[model samples]
Target: MCIAVFLWQAHPLYPLFLLRNRDEYPSRPTEPVAWWDNGEILGGRDGLAGGTWLACSRSGKIAFVTNVAEVGKVPEPKSRGDLPVRFLESKKNPTEFAEEVVMEAHQYNGFNLILVDLSSKSMIYVTNRPKDEKALVSEVPPGIHVLSTASLDTPWPKAVRLRTNFEKFLEKHGSGELPAEEMADKLMTDATKADKTMLPGIYSVEFEHSLSSIFVEANTDQGRYGTRSISAVSVKTSGEVAFYEKYLEEESWIEHTASYVMEQTGTG
Candidate 1:
C-alpha cells in the first residue's frame, strides 16, 4: 500500500507541498523519478504497467493514486495506475477529468485518485469503491490532508500520525522554504506499526499491521515488499516546482531532484 500527506492552498509560499511513500515488492521493475520519454511528465514509472502512481505534467497538472485495502476481490480489467496518466494528459480541468473517470470507474480496481490543476487552483478527489455505491467525485477543500489505502483522510492510524507531524513541521518552518530531504528522512521513513486493534480489518490483522507504518517493510510469501521510494514535491507560488525522490535500486539507495518553473497560463 502507499500513503501521502499534502498541504494544499494552505501554505503561503508554496500552494501545494506533498510527500508520498511508494510501497511495493522490491523485485518489481520500476523507473525512478524522471521526465517520461514524451518529455512532458515527471515521476517514477511502474515498468510492468507503463504507468505511474504519482506524476505531474509541464502544464501544471498533477495526479496521484493509492490502492484501496480490501480482500476477496477479483482483479479488474484496467490498471489503476493509468488513472493518473490519463488525468495528466487530458486538456480537461480537474472536475471534468474526474467526471470522465466516474464513467469508467468500474473498469479498474479499487482506487483513490487525486487530480490537480495549478492554473485553475482546483483539486478533485475521486474514488470508485465501496462497490455498492456510485463513484465519488468532489472538490478538495484547502488544507492539510492525507490519503492512504482508504478514503481521503479516513483517520487511519498512519494518516493521523502523518498529519500531526506535518502540522508540527509547518509550524516550525513558518513560511520558509521547506527542507525536502530532511523532511523525507525524518517523517516518511517512520516504521512505527499500529497495534492489532488499530488495523482497518479489511485484511488480516497480521497483514494490515505489516503495512501500518508510514514506511512499510514486510516479508510475505510474495517475497520482500515495502516502501521502495519516498517523494517530496513542493510547488511555489512563484511558478517554481521542486520534485525530489529517494529510491532504492539494486539494494542501494539513490536520490534525485528535478526542478522547473510551471508554464504561466494566466488562468492559474
Candidate 2:
C-alpha cells in the first residue's frame, strides 16, 4: 500500500506545500517518471520502484499515483509514474485535470492519481483501474477519501474505533504552530494513541512509525504551506538498503507538502 499527505507553508511562495508519508512498494523495475539519459522525469523504472507516491513542483502543483495491480487489468509498464507527473505539469483546474487523464489514458497503464494545484485553488482525483475512467472533484460531505479500495477511510474493525475523533481533527483544525518534529510525531503516534484508525496501514515492518506525521496549512501568503511526514520502512533500518522518499531536494518537496496544507486549509 502507498499513501501521502501534503501540507502548506509560507515562503518565496509558488503556493508552497509539504509532503509527508509518501511510501510505496513498486513493481521490481520501478515506474519511470521522466525521460532518462536526458535528465527528464518522464516515467521510467529502476526495478519495480516506489516512493514517488507524492510530489510537488515550485509551480504550486502536487500529484501522486498508485498502481492497482490486478490479474485481469492490462499489464502495468515499468514507466507509469510519468502519468501523475505529467498531470501535475498540465491542467489548470480539478475538472480539466480529471477529464484530460480520462480521455488520454491510453498513453499509459492503469492507476489512481490525485492532483492539487494552488494556482487555481483546486483538487481532483482520477483512476483508470476500473472499467471506466473515474474522476471527482474534492468536495464536502465526501468524508476522508480512500482510493483504489472499496471503501474510504478506515475499513477495518480495529481502525474504525477512531473515525469520529479523527474526522473532528481534520475538520476543526487549521494551520498548526507545532514544531516540525512534534507534528510529525503526532501524526504518526496520534492515530495509534487515540485508536487504531488514524491510518489504514500504520503498522508493519514495510510500514514504520518513523514518519511522525504530516501537516499542511491551506491558506497562506499565496494560500499554500505544509510540513512533517509519516513515512517508515524496515529497509532503511537494515543500513545496507537505501530507501528514497520523494522530494529530497530542489523546489520539488516544498510544493508537495504545501499541497497537503492547501487541501487541509481549503481556498478560504
Candidate 3:
C-alpha cells in the first residue's frame, strides 16, 4: 500500500477504521480480497510474491505495510510483503512480534508495518528504515495517523491532505455511521499536480504528476501505473468486522465486501 490512514478507538460504534490506497503498476496480477483456503487470514493476495500488503485474521488481528521511499536503496532478497502476512498468521503478542521483526528487518527492503490486536485494544507501529540504520517501534496512541512511502506521518502533501480529510469526515459524522462507499470515495479523490509544492527531502519535482493525488495514474517504462485498490475496514467495539474493498478485476473496477465476527476467545 502506498498511502494509508487509520483511526483507532475514535468511534463509538466502530473501535477501529482503516482506509488505504494500494498503488502499483496496473499490469500486476492480483487476487481480490478473499479467505485463503490454506490459511484463516482474509486479504487480497499479491500474485507475484504470494504475500499481502494488508490482511486481517478472524482472531481480530490486523496488519498493513507500506514501502519506504528512498532513491537508489539496494533491494533486499526477502519480500517486504511477508511482514504483514507473517504477523497475521503467527500467535505472538503485538509487541513481541514487532520486536521479532526488528531483529530481521534489515534482511528485507525498507518498510513500515502496523499491527493491531482488536480484542486487547493494542496497536504497534514499526519501521526498519529510520534516519539511522536502526529500527523503531512504538505502541501507537489512540487517534488518527497517516503512512506513506516517505515514512510514518512524514507530512508529504498527499498524506497530509488525506489525513485532514479523514479528520474532517470524523468530525462531521461524530457518532454517526459513515457509509462505506463514501469512505472509499474519499480515498479516490484526486489532488492535481499543481496543488503540490516540492519539499526538499520529503518530495520533489521528480515525483510523477499522478502521485499528487490519493488515486494515481502515471506512465512508466513498465506501462500504466496507478492506484489499484482502495480498501477500508470497520471494526465495532463488540468485534464485528466489515471489510470494503475496490479494485480492478478483469479490466473493470469492482467493489467487494466481507464480514467476520470475532470469536469470544480471540481465536478464529
Candidate 4:
C-alpha cells in the first residue's frame, strides 16, 4: 500500500480516471502484467509475491489505493492490488465496477481509488476514510486533478507532498513538458518539510531525490510500483492525448503499468 493519483471531471471522450502507485516491501507477494504468450489478456496480480500495484485499462477504466484502514476485525479483506488486475482485465462499466466493489468492501482493507471509463466518461472515488467516516465517492471534473485525503488540488504534508509539488509544476508549465528528472531537486524541499502523515521516515530519504526526477510523470499501469512516467502528457491541445511510464527497481513501478487490462487503453 503506497500512493494513488486520480481525477474527477466533466470532459469529452473520457472523464473519470485514475493513476495509482502501490508501494510495499519487496517480499510481500505480487506479479507482473504479461500479454499472455498467445496474446490473451491475463492482466496481472497484486501481492502475488511482493507484487506492486498500479493500473488502468484500454477502456480508460482504472483503480488503485493505499492502506488507509486495515480491516483486522473483518478478516482483513484480500488486498487492494488484487482488485485492479481483476477490474482492468475485465470490460466492466464504471458504474458496475464501483457497485461491485461497494458490495464487497469487507473483502479488502482501507484504501482509496478513482475508477474511470473512457467509453462512458464517468469517474468515481471509492474511499474508506479510516474508521472515522463511512466509505464515500463522487464525480470529478475535467482538467488534471490531484487527490489524496480529498479531491484537493494541493499538497498535504507527508509522502503526498512530493505529488503536490508536482502539481505546482503543472501550473507553472501550463503543460507537462517540464522535465521531471530535472526537477528532482524540488523534492528535497518537500522532504525537508514536516512529516504530517507520520507513516515512516520516507521524508528522510531526500538523498534519493535524484530518482524522483526520472519517474515523476504519472499514469495507469497493470501491476507496478515507484514513480512511473507511464504515459507522458504530451500534445495537450484540444482532441489529443499522450503519456509514458516506467516502474521501480524492487519491480513495483514496473508492475503498475501492465496492471491495466480491458478497461485501460490509449488516450484520445
Ranking by TM-score: 1, 3, 4, 2
Q: Write down the worst ten-residue block by lDDT for model 2.
A: 233-242
**All candidates: TM-score:** 0.96, 0.48, 0.92, 0.60
lDDT of 4 at 122: 64
Q: Give lDDT tens digits, candidate 1, residues 1-268.
A: 8999999998878878999999999888899999998999999999999889999988999999999887745465688889999989888999999989999888877899999999889999999874346449878999999999888888999999999999899999998988988998899999999889988888778888999999999988889899999999989888888999999999888999999988854322
| Candidate 4 lDDT tens digits, 1-268 | 2334433342233233234333434444544444433353333355453222544444454455445523243465576666665666666765677778777776766666566555555666676542336345556566656543332333334346655655666557652345433343343222243433333333334422322322232222332233322322222113233323343445343412233333333334
**Segments in model 4 whose C-alpha atoms lie over 4 Å from true places:** 6-20, 29-44, 47-52, 69-73, 130-135, 147-155, 175-190, 193-246, 250-268
**Quality of model 4 by C-alpha lDDT:** 0.44
lDDT of 2 by residue, 128-240 (tens): 65433333333212233433222223243322332433334444544332233333344423333222344345344222222212222222333322222243111111111
lDDT of residue 10 for candidate 3: 69
Alpha carbon lDDT of residue 69, candidate 2?
Answer: 33
Query: Which is the leading candidate under TM-score?
Result: 1
**Candidate 3 worst ten-residue window by lDDT:** 194-203
lDDT of 3 by residue, 156-188 (tens): 778888888888888888888877679778555
> Any idea what lDDT model 2 has?
0.38
TM-score of 1: 0.96
Misplaced by over 4 Å in model 2 are 5-20, 24-51, 69-71, 76-78, 106-110, 130-180, 189-268
Local accuracy by lDDT, each model: 0.90, 0.38, 0.80, 0.44
How much RMSD separates candidate 4 from the native structure?
7.7
